[model samples]
Target: MNAPAHDNGRLALMLNELRLPTIGRLWPEFAERSDKEGWQASRLLGALFEHELAERAKRRIERHRNESHLDPSKTLATLEFGLLPMVSKAHVMALASGESWLEKGATILMFGPPGTGKSHLGSAIGHALIDVGYRVLFTRTSELVQKLQAARKSLQLPSALAKLDRFDLIILDDLSYARKDQAETSVLFELIAERYERKSLLITANQPFSGWNDVFPDPGMTVAAIDRLVHHSTIFELNVESYRRRKASDKQSARQRQLPEKNQEGGTTIMS
Candidate 1:
């Protein structure tokens, strides 16, 4: 038989918020059904409610963990078709082997021409590292160099690099995109030297090693930097067609023949 529905005044608000049906609907049904059930039906219902609450707590914890992960939102799914098989196949296996250089400390160099998906691949790897619970710092090569110079002026260079060391993986995207002076080049090389073997470095560049001398400005420093970078690194050369060109062509073809109307509702406000 079921126990009497007590005056649950203390939890009445909570029960109502949980959408638990009131006695008006449930009490009569329980009373009518209790005669047939040998066990206490109310106890069974309470047990079910407790079990559901526990399950919900577990789910909430899992959701929080997933959301807390530094998901860069870069995934293998968004990778362009041309670069997929090569990067995802044996390459992933090679890097993931032994102590996980990707997880531990190693370097990955992705060299290719502009619009060949270099940044996308580097970012995807960073996201993959984050999934493995490694802290990753990502920035464009140009921006990193600029920030380092700014730090030197503020006398915070050491502190800045110290913070960089905390990251398990560092991704420098678009290396050599903007023209860098000799001092900036030296600072960048020093960063690589300092981080050598201490943390994993992921570099994406539009130019190959052969063309890197243009970035370093000094031929001797260029050779030294390239030597240090390639010594213990996995290199991928992407020689694919420009995805940007394809996108541009599609956009051009979709242009309307007639002039589109422009809306200038407010002064100096332009809308197309």
Candidate 2:
């Protein structure tokens, strides 16, 4: 039964005021059932709160996911972990499930050749973290360096870093793309130093530590950045073959194999 007009209107108003629209809109039906069953006040109140909290959580997850700036297609369901023998599914699932390591500012460093799905893995984990309420930002190494460099020119580098501090984890894709120049490397170094042990980082790179000199201007700076990043981090070396190449090869082979299977039995076989 519908609630009385006055009760419906006033209850809706109260729900709006208290920011519990989910429970407010449906409470009238619940109220009718409660009246029928003689549910106590505490039970009714608890039901309302449970709906409200569930809605709040849903909204929170959406908000975080939108703000994460990650590839929407990259998610746990999209990643074919079986093809990547080097990747440990257990470890990645653990990291994705729990926020302790990310919240405490531990870094995840992923290294691999191009097309090896390093970026995919990084973005997927980032989205998973967002699902669990961790604020994450995905950016390329070059783009972030350019942003930081521009901020430095305007003397707002500190302000920029302050803004970045809001995210729980920063996914820096293509860490190997940073140009080997003082101006570029300096800003990159500053960014690393600022987040050192203060915020979590997820970095994808094509180069190993010994080859990092190509990105940094000097050996000392490279060492410094490496030291801070590796101090509390999980290094994932993705040595498997490129996923793109493998996928393309599979498609080609499928087409090639289908050509001989249908000729004699099929209704039509075109000949020029």
Candidate 3:
């Protein structure tokens, strides 16, 4: 009778059959190193498994990051914390880790003016969460509401909401930009209701809750939306000088200083 195939060959075949390409490809080199170094069988196997697990984790994180649609430039590393004192660095870091209040399907409301870093901060948080394996999707509130309205018109709102559930966190930027139409607000309400107590939301709004009435014309709807969102939420009020506005002013001042002075009669005059 022909001798049975060797155990090493059988093991390689089985690993490939299971589709564990990483482990299968590396095992031959791992075994060679073990023999050359006189390593214990247990130690050699442990190293192999560790390498496989690490590679799998890296690929998983990469997949999540690509699907997240986050701003590659926005992250805590790039944040100008000194420019905004109202927001605590420690608190922002805690939330970015996605292991604190996010556990309870909580909401985060970032309130600030247009020139402030509201959208930047929101996208940064999403990037951080995705790095640690959280699924995040970021979009403008107006754009998202339009999509929901389209789904409703097509009678596929439920399917659309179900697809959105794939994200562990949703970052909705510029909430105040959503039009104050009844049809639009209704879909927005539906999204909030679906995610309530189920998934986390981070919203950046140029207006405060009191002014939210301008987005949802119905007073009852405004009250209901605010009540649900703020009940289990953390609000970040960035009451700092507008970063964009300050930069623009600085540029204007530099230009003015570079220009030659003109007398009231409109002739260029050299300064003494």
Which candidate achieves the best TM-score against the true structure? 2
Candidate 3 ranges with C-alpha deviation above 4 Å: 1-16, 245-272
lDDT (10s digit) by residue, model 3, range 55-121 = 9889988888888778788788887777777878898888889976667899999998897888788
User: How much lDDT does candidate 1 score?
Assistant: 0.67
lDDT of 3: 0.85
Q: What TM-score does prediction 3 earn?
A: 0.83
Q: Considering summed lDDT, which 10 consecutive residues are worst modelled in model 3?
A: 259-268
Per-residue lDDT of candidate 2, residues 38-70 (tens digit): 999899989988998988999988988888889
Give each model a TM-score. Answer: 0.62, 0.88, 0.83
Q: What's the distance in Å from true for residue 122, model 2? A: 0.9
lDDT values, one for every candidate: 0.67, 0.86, 0.85
Q: Which is the better candidate, 1 or 2, if ranked by TM-score? A: 2
133-161: candidate 1 lDDT, tens digit per residue: 55677787787888887888898988888
lDDT of 2 at 160: 96
Candidate of highest lDDT: 2
